[model samples]
Target: MRGAFSTNKTMGEAPEMFYVNGFAKVVPEVQPNHVNNVDDSSTWYEEIIDDDLKWSFKLNSVLHKAISEYQDIALLDTKRFGKALMLDGKMQSSEADEFIYHECLIHPSLLCHSNPKTVFIMGGGEGSAAREALKHKSMEKVVMCDIDKEVVDFCRKYLVANKEAFADKKLDLVINCAKAELEKRKEKFDIIVGDLADPLEDGPCYQLYTKSFYEKVVKPKLTENGIFVTQAGPAGIFSHKEVFTSIHNTIKQVFKYVVAYGTHVPSFADSWGWVMASDQPILIDAVEMDKRIEERIKGKLLYLDGAWFHSSTIMNKAVSKSLKNETHVYTEDNARFIPGHGIACRP
Candidate 1:
């Protein structure tokens, strides 16, 4: 809830010097006579949430920083969240709460399907999505396609939790744009996951969220009983309409049964939304969902369980009404990008 660092001057005082830390470098906001007035306690990382708002945290330490072809990347350790990953100045994942995100993203759709033997993950460069998918005893093959090899390599080297999943025999990792990769393949998947970056106006990921891509490319590549799921951005009471409602409405255009759900992610500072769709009706109740979790999954899910999953689907009145009334169908020209997203792509 901290305000963004300011350089504006006071009425009679000298120019202000604000220092926001990045990759261990404490660059000072230098002005007349204020160049040397850097405060050591001001070493924090800040993310813009809106024109008038920002979020920041005190940095314990910074591990890495670099600019890749697709985006800028950083790794930092914090007292509150453990190790954290940053891309394009936006928080991607935090060690303390990442399990909540990864489990929720991969488990629901996979468990809903009767037998999900083959799975495809788009842009799970961190290997967390593949890790959760592989835990299902029914999985035979899991393909993870990410456009940026650098991100994948960085994750492989540093994300110690997913190392075993990356080395597993069933995983087929590919470095390519997900859309182009899916188009080239003749094989189909039982579950397809969009574990992608938020759709930013400057990001290349906006097209991947469009109706054209879903119907023309993604829908045709799924098996008859297949399910498609994607993270649908922020679902806070004041923020759900940015992408979540429109994403649900757009998918309803192509699928027979579609459901939008959400859960609070502490690190994200909002309730994150997800949309799941399939041709087959989802008939299982919470009790049945729990039974499947016992029989199918290898380890206990830290964040999601049958009861929690059921509750997540029951949206608040405001979001429910917005979803019902939404008319937007995502297209290249008409797409909506998250306003708070960091510039994650060149185009």
Candidate 2:
């Protein structure tokens, strides 16, 4: 399988969960009481907490060691990150995010597309999105690329729920930087899903969110009718009126239409964003989309359905209302989204 992939911010009584390696080694703590620091096994954000619960602390402390060091697999805490287990073997949450993030990211685009068959997913280390994309009987293939192989290894070793998603036969797993992978493939997909983190000034992923890169590296890869969907940022905290406007503005330069969507992840209260860009005019018919998704999804689920899509729109509007006009774009180049900053763009 590709790999495993939380939150503690809600009104209800949060569940009891913990963060640990596959072998069940406890993750470290950030503030200990409010938030615990998991060991640095994965390469995303810091200070993961069982925020959903009444518990004082929860998180693994594994440092970011090389892929060779991770060992063991076990369920640490379910209440913290909403994940059934924590893994240390591979370290990336590509698979988890695919189901959790990618579903929310891609389905909207697919709904907007008149016909979507071939797809490309960049930065999906866990292959969860690849798993979801396969649900469409009409889909031909899903090509997913990620820079870290270690994340995939640990997730395969630790998270069992993600096994099917990562092992899907139709998926082409590319263990390389997403931008580099995109450069090698030209106009090959009808839909492109970008699950990358905020761009860094100095890193392989920096180009994924750049204005220049989208115009050059990313745009050319799309088919004439393709729609590009991306996790923009935490809409809740980043109400970056400019960044959001800029993102929409930037994509409009190439595509005829650019829009945003939202999904509430308790783990990242103010740190979620998704952008859906397309060359054709788009409209989301909720009634039809829900029926399609319901017919496609097989297993049981506590969240996600047509109502979820409606809620996503509401959340986006709420975030938009919260943002000030002078706000700056909150990309990976800056710090993670802080809750009170009005920049939470968690679509």
Candidate 3:
């Protein structure tokens, strides 16, 4: 463990300095063989969701942490969530509840379309998106593009739940900027899912969420009846309201119809929001949508079914009002980057 020192200054005489040594008074001082030691005293991985709220998990062991070419990548073996992935200090996914997020993001868009063949996923390096997309028998091809190759490699080795997703024959793994590649390709996709990280200013995802990116790059790649959806961040009334509203409003700029929906993911500790947009109508009738899932989508699903499809799509009243009042549209020139909360190591 690393140690820190503090000094007390005297009035006129020479100032006195003192070294606190070890973890600090608040954290228990227990040295382990490895940096990520799992014992009575373990380190924590914490992420701030907003100014006042933060979520943390006890890390049994830190598998890897490296400065990838584009961003910082971290893989941790956690007590509650199992193996977890953190990109640039933000929680990307955890073993426990990743299905809720991946399923909600991919399925709603794909099932809404009559027959989605080709799919493009952005920033879901863990391969869960591709795995969920493949469950649709109509899906012929899935192109998973992520800016950081290291994150994908780490997840492939350590993330147990969806590791096989990386090896599926239909998945084309591309380690590059997604928007740039999609712009160059003439082929169009029936479903485009943006499973990207929060739009921090210096991060690679900031520009992808802007109005111009969707209008110029993403819109061109979508088929006439295609659907586009992206993770819109925390949707709780007291959480990151601005981020959720901005994402919804921005997508509305390009598509003829847009809908914002929220679902609770236990690992995320909030009702996370996602936005789906399309020129064609999205199925809101729960029964009809459920029938389509049963006929078209294969395999057993954990969270998404008939009842879930109906309940999860309904927006909270406060969230609806927040969207009405929020006028800020995220553009490249006027993007605001929100910093994550601090992480603390506990005894």
Candidate 4:
């Protein structure tokens, strides 16, 4: 399912329309009125997370821009975060702190498993998730599935940090809807990572976060002692409370044990939340976990270690109470995730 790259469209033009699999669709054009307009006076890219909260980065240059079938993709060279990737106006990853998000999202679950070999990554088109998974010497194969081929191609071309990952022969790139692809595949993995975008109401990822997707599509694909982990949402008590708790509670319904954790990602401007769930115990002794990580993972890690692993699992009282009180389960019928709005810090 490879998408053809078009350098034909010019800036400020109505976006071109293309057909995929018999359906006619128009690639979303970046409106001149949107943030990061790249006018003569401004070179700043702004990401509006909620109505009031937005983060702005000074752009060095525009690396690539595309309106894919799934979402609008932009790769920008920023003064602070280096090369940054954005999907539909949301910041996905940045060079300066990407290791924090990718390392936290990947290593925790992989280290929790006794021996994680085969890995399946969903929606991590940037290649960092697959890169981290391959860090383990025991990793035999990694399958990274993303819905939009253009995102993967763009990242591979402009994001130098993940270049080795894209070139790794052991990696298998699949461009398709992850849920549909996983359902058809007969092979199961030791670690299943959901490195998807925030599930907004009209977003492509809303269905992926639903209880039905986890129960019917994801669970059966895991090995007996396998672990499932995903990026939950912003961990601020005042922001995105329902999004975090709903993911936790929904996964709790399927797995015997579930734990929610948080870590500060500078580019995101908040302590981001992540959830790990497995029928088997996930909280291993800190000492033993450290030993396994040292022995298995070969490269220098940026943000995660044994002590951080134990501390990350421990949540504040307010967060714990919120999870305890949250009774809603996210199903396909009731899946409406509205991203937090309200200005936090002005650029």
**Cα lDDT, all candidates:** 0.84, 0.55, 0.78, 0.82
What RMSD does model 2 have?
Answer: 9.6
Superposed model 4: Cα runs more than 4 Å off: 1-42, 340-347
lDDT of 4: 0.82
- By summed lDDT, the worst window of 10 consecutive residues in model 4 runs over 338-347
lDDT of 3 at 196: 91
Which digits, one per residue and each the tens of the lDDT, describe model 3 over residues 230-260?
A: 9998887677465888888888888999888
Give TM per candidate.
0.89, 0.67, 0.86, 0.85
On residues 175-217, what C-alpha lDDT tens digit does candidate 1 reach at each position? 9999999999999999999999888777658899999999999
Off by over 4 Å in 3: 1-39, 341-347
Q: Between prediction 3 and prediction 4, which has the larger lDDT?
A: 4
- Which candidate has the top score in lDDT? 1
| Model 2 lDDT tens row, 15-56 | 333232122223333442465435433312233222231212
Name the top TM-score candidate: 1
Runs in model 1 with CA error above 4 Å?
Answer: 1-42, 340-347
Of the candidates numbered 2 and 3, which has the greater TM-score value? 3
Q: Which is better, 1 or 2, measured by lDDT?
A: 1
Sort the predicted structures by lDDT, highest score first.
1, 4, 3, 2
